[model samples]
Target: MTTETSVDVTRIPRITHDEATAITAVENRKFGEQLRSLGPDDWIASTDCERWDVRAMAAHVVGGAAGQISPREFVRQVRTGRPIVREIGAKHWWDGMNEVQVRERSDVSTDELIAEWDTNSEKARIARNKLPKPIGRLPLLNLPEPVGRQPLTYLFDMGFTRDVWAHRMDIAAATGHPMDLDATHDGRIIADIVAEWAGYFDEPFTLELTGPAGGTFTSGSGGETVRIDALEFMMILAERTEGTGLLQHTLPL
Candidate 1:
């Protein structure tokens, strides 16, 4: 695997607006399909997310989509959720927002949840893609260390899609749902992740990631070499599993 041609991390281009929009739409549809296929048992299954079952995970996805449908909706969620998060002793406002999301939809039936996801995900795609360039370039918030601050475009283009993709993996693990990975779509996302990971750590290493979405990536030379499954690597980066050494550094999902 190491013998495969190495991709220069610096050369990997940022995902363009069109690519981001397309990927987000595809991911949303796939997630909705996965939700629709869940059975009663699957809905209640425990996932890698410590506090969430499959149902709660789905609710979070729906809530995230709803918030992204409009700037007004997004602000409303932040305003309503930040105080609640502080009350709950959570460090991040998003934790409160996620909690509120799950609580609001706790009583929603499985079918209704699926329906809402379908509607809101579509609306989110439209709203995000329609964001004016000037607004998108503005910094959204100041995040913690490693991720000091991010622009609105980061959320629209990468953050939200990565969040849903990571959670989709979570749902699949809990329910044994077959993931529909392909070289084209999933591969693109994985490659982008590799680029970010390599750039963030900025050390010498060779990564041999196996599976349809996998590839060989290298940065500098003579660094630690790691071989792992592509999806599992992503799971680690998303902090769903413990990692060691270089892998311990993570990118926000």
Candidate 2:
């Protein structure tokens, strides 16, 4: 006989709409700054996402922001992404949407890419924050496997922010650029991730994550003790690097 365990969603700390908005606003600005800092050669640098160079990653980020700017744009992306998803044999429509985003921007200059990202990200932030409550409460379309189903607000608020943040880390790793990290913003984001990760197992553990964005976390009583670099722990949860024991479980960035 076998049994399976699942995350207790209720146990995870919730990020409210207001907090989500603030976090994303900061994250988007930081991401843009990182993009602008990239040298010409850095644009061609390989990231952890094997198929994408830094430019492609930035394009995808811009596309994500653009899609969020309005319902029309989001629908268009979904409609246009269908065929590409099929052609690429991708398991999800988002994969196709990402491809479309990258392909459409392939000819764009690095400067143009950064500019577009800046504009679209700002627009995206406003649109998301102003989204109708009814719509925000609705479930998302084609939710990714690791994340499962979540409200539309989840994508607009936390999901997109996390994606940009993770990509920033990827770019930094690829090009040796220093990340601007602090206790307030990055630490809060990491704490939320920790809460969710701890809930995923629904087990007791003590985790001490080190670095500016890191903190000590515990779930239930002591079951296991773990200590690791904060960013590296995120890498493990994101599956950019293999994890062992409890760390083997993954959550999409």
| Prediction-by-prediction clash tally | 0, 0
State the lDDT at 129 in candidate 1.
Answer: 86
Number of the predicted model whose TM-score against the real structure is largest: 1
The reply for model 2, stretches above 4 Å from the true place, is 1-13
Q: By TM-score, how accurate is candidate 1? A: 0.94
lDDT of 1 by residue, 152-233 (tens): 8888887899899899989988898777787677888888888866776667888888888787887888888898888888
User: Which candidate number has the best lDDT?
Assistant: 1
- The C-alpha TM-scores of every prediction are 0.94, 0.91
Question: Candidate 2 versus the native: TM-score?
Answer: 0.91
Root mean square deviation (Cα) for candidate 2? 5.6
